[model samples]
Structures are given as C-alpha cells and as structure tokens.
Target: MSVELWAQPAMMSDPAPEQMMEHILKRVGDIPPLPVVATKILSMVNDPDLEVDDLVSVIQKDQGLTAKILRVSNSAFFGLCRTITTVKEAVVTLGLNNIRNQVIALCARSMLETRAEGYALEAGGLWEHSLGTAFCAERLSSTLGLKGTADQVFVGGLLHDIGKSILSYYVATRFQPILRLVDGEGLTFVEAETQELGFDHAEIGARVALRWNLPEALVDMIAHHHGPSRESKNRTQVCIVHVADAIASMLGLGLGVGGLENRIDDEAIAHLGVDDQVVQDVMVHMSSIGDLRAHIGIN
Candidate 1:
C-alpha cells in the first residue's frame, strides 16, 4: 500500500484537524510546558561536564521539587536506612540522576493531569499509562542490560506517547474514522492515524519533545516508541518503550483505543540479542502490572 509518511512537517497556520493536531503536537505551545526549575535540572543532568554542585543548585532552586525528592527518598519506595533532609544529602544518597528523575516525574504530574478532549482519555488514565510504561521500561532495561540510566529509560517510557496528549485535543473529534479503520480494517494506531488524520502521534510527539529542549536521545525514544525500527540512537530504549507500551495497553492501564494490533518489534529484539527467556521473564513479572495500576498516583 502506498502511504504518505507520517513524517512531521513544519508548524503552519490553522489547517484541518489532522494538520492542527500535527501543528499543536509538533509545537510545544499545545502541551503543558515543563516547569522552569525542572527544565534546568534536566539540562544539567543531560550535560556530561556538569558539576555535581550545579545539579544540587538547580534542585535547591525549586523548593517544592527539593522537598518532594527528599520525601520520596525517605519514603518506603527507596528503603533508605536514614532520613534525608537536604538537597546535597538527597543527591549523595539517591544519586544525582535518580533525584533529578524523581523530580521530573513529580513535576510532570501537574502538567499531565488536565482533561484532553480530542482523545477522550481522562487526566488520570494518561498519567497511569505513562507511569506503567516507566515502570516496565525500568524492569525491561535491567533484564536487557541496556546502556543507559534507569531514570532516563523511565523518562523515555513516560514521555513516549506524549504526542497522544496533543492528539486527544486536536483529533479526538475527528478520530472516530481512524479508530474505525483500526477496528474494521485491523490497522495499527499509526496506520489508522495516517489513513484518517494524515499523521501519527509518534511524529507529532517527537517534534514536541524536540521543541521542549529535551535530550536528543529522549526525543528519539518518544518519536519511535511506537516504531522502534525508525532511526534512534538508543534502539534498545526504543524497543523497551515499544514493549512497555504494548504491555500497558494490553493490560488496559489507560485508554487510547486499546486492542490495536500490538506490534512486537521483532527486528529490535533480534538486534538487541534478547532471547525468549528474557521475554518470558518480563511477561511473568508484568503479568500483574494492571492490578498494581491503582497503587500509583492515578485517580
């Protein structure tokens, strides 16, 4: 089938709902902006030459983020033996990257919790799905020994389908035909999107991440989370996200026209040398991921 690629286009004037969806999603203005403090923390974390104190300074600047990090460190999740009250203490105890990741996750809550009309997905549903994907990515990374920080993997998984947020707003009203195509014709979400909307969420999301000044690795992960074969510096991360997304959607953690043909990313699996045993283990571990969904911050 000859298909016009869902390749992202430059932002333009108001157009059809499909184009508007692309414009709104590809441009950062449509989605909630990451907090300035969080942005700074991400910037420093992404820098290889950044000093430890620089990261501490950025964390200290956001009093709320600092407090949240400290609280989570002390929480049962980390199982820290001692209490951590200061930014330096938290950083030293939790690792700078870990703390930065925690802050980013916390900060994302506010931005992702708003209602989006275009996709018919509620605030809690999207966040739940994102969180689930993050958890799965971390687990999968450990299983695969992928060369990247777990926190980075978590962030990649969480933000992978952020374009869907834009889709919900711009294309939801016009997306029925896309869903119909998926159901009646058995097309995947990307294929159905292209058939009906002229673009897919992955393309729009990649552009969104780029506009946000997110790390290049992260932008690619989000862009190709659905299409791991697409160009990406971290193909393992892309595959992790793809599997994690498939797992979450299959378990029905969040709503996004679930039951779409779950793409397995066989090429990436073979490239990464992941054997059947690892896949089995992931399946066993995540078998109950859905039941645990309510335990997360999702409403």
Candidate 2:
C-alpha cells in the first residue's frame, strides 16, 4: 500500500489485483482521446440519418485524414477505374461503409503504432496484427452473413487488443512472474495477466473503448474477444472478433511475448457457424493486408 502503485506499476510484486484495476483505469485516462473527426465518422455508423455529405463534411475538417482517405480510395485494392480527386468523390465512389473503415484504420494506426513495452510488441508489430485481424473480422462477417457493415465488424477486430498498449509497461515489470503462471501453472496469457495484474488486457481494453466513447457493441466486442462469458449479451459480435483474433495469432501476425499460449474458443466457432476450413479460407484471403498499410500505416 505504501508503494506508488500508479507511478511504478512495473515495479510492483504481485500487488492487489482489485486495487490495481482502479489505478489502471485511472492511468488509461491519460491516453489521448480519439481525433474528433475519427469520432464523428464512427457516429455515422450509429446514425443512419447521417448522410454522405455529413461524412464528407467531418472528414474534410481534418485535411490529413482527408488526404489519406482519398489515397486509399484510389488504391488498386479497390480497383477504381478513375482517380478519387476529393473526399466527397471518394465517399461516393467507395461507399460510406468503406470510407468509414478507412477513417477508423487511420485512427487505429495512430493509436496502435506505439511499441507496447511489456508485451514486447515492437514498432508496427501491434499495428500489423490489428490490421490483419480487422481484415479477417470484416471478411468473416460477410462470409457468415452477419448482417453488419464491414466497418462494424472491422472495428472490433482492430481495437480488440488496445488494452495491451497501456498494459505493456506493467506487464514488462511482471513479465517473469506472469510467465511463470503460464509456464509453471499452464495458464493462458490473459489468465496470467488477471491473476498477476488484477485485470487482463481484454478487461482494460473495454475500459479504454468506453473512455473513447466507442459504441456499446464495439466495446463489448473488445471486452469478450478473449473468452465470451456465458451471460454475454453480445455473444455473436464478440465471437466474430474473438475468432478473428485467434486467426491472427494462427497466422503469427504479432504474438510477441504473448506467444501462442492462448487457444481459440470453440464456442466462438459454433456461434459463428464456422469450422477450421472456413477459418482457413479467411486466412488465405487476407492477402490485402499490405494494401491497408500503404494507405494508413505508412507515413
């Protein structure tokens, strides 16, 4: 109790996990808010009444985001016959859903590009994994007929691991002990995290999403992406992100110190009505991962 828990989370030796959650929540408050333009674009997904003009209007407010949006829109991935000359043209040609996905991707690149010190996620490692998962989630939703826009599913896959960004430092300090829980006791990475740090990254990720004012569904997806609870209200959506995260791991996108200790949830598979073959097809189809990096991740 005497130690500065928040200031020195890395140095703590198995302090109270319950108390640690309180401090972790407070520390996450220090993470900067999402760009206003990014926030408004997400709102468009929630508000059907918001038209394409409204989308263009908010995106144009930030010229950097606007340029990135147009550049991505005209990429060969979309196979546009003509160049996208403006934000409005990009939105109209590519459609609002894809445009929103681009905005979120750019925001995710900014937020996830940092090296998570504890998880040993090097520069671009986390971003690469996140983008891979986003591609899988968006694809899986379509293959399963999940009745949601690609961006809606993409949001969960992309940000499911956001909590790791903040927890990296704390995990680094307790890495040896946490690894003991995994190696000696055979716990998953998340179980070790919760036992040692009080809350796992998924729990902290939900808190971060909440702080960013992300939609409840998206927040819930991040919350249960690791292991969906029996009582979870958003099981279907969580299953999509969970499965996508597992697929990303299988592809070895960004395992870092987390490694392959965590197994994919079978319940998630059943909920989405998918099997290994379906997952395999999705993995094979993830070739366009670089297309996104070119538009958003690359400076």
* Maximum-lDDT candidate: 2
Q: Per-residue CA lDDT of candidate 1, range 102-216, in tens?
A: 7777877654555545556666677777887877777777888764556677788778777776555446555787778878998876788766767777787787777788887
lDDT of 2 by residue, 104-143 (tens): 8787776687777678888778888888788888888888
TM-score for each of the candidates? 0.80, 0.88
Alpha-carbon shift of residue 293 in model 2 (angstroms)? 1.5
- The lDDT of each candidate is 0.68, 0.77
Q: How far is candidate 2 from the true structure (C-alpha RMSD, Å)?
A: 4.0
TM-score of 2: 0.88
Model 2 weakest 10-residue run by lDDT: 1-10
Model 2: per-residue Cα lDDT at residue 182: 88
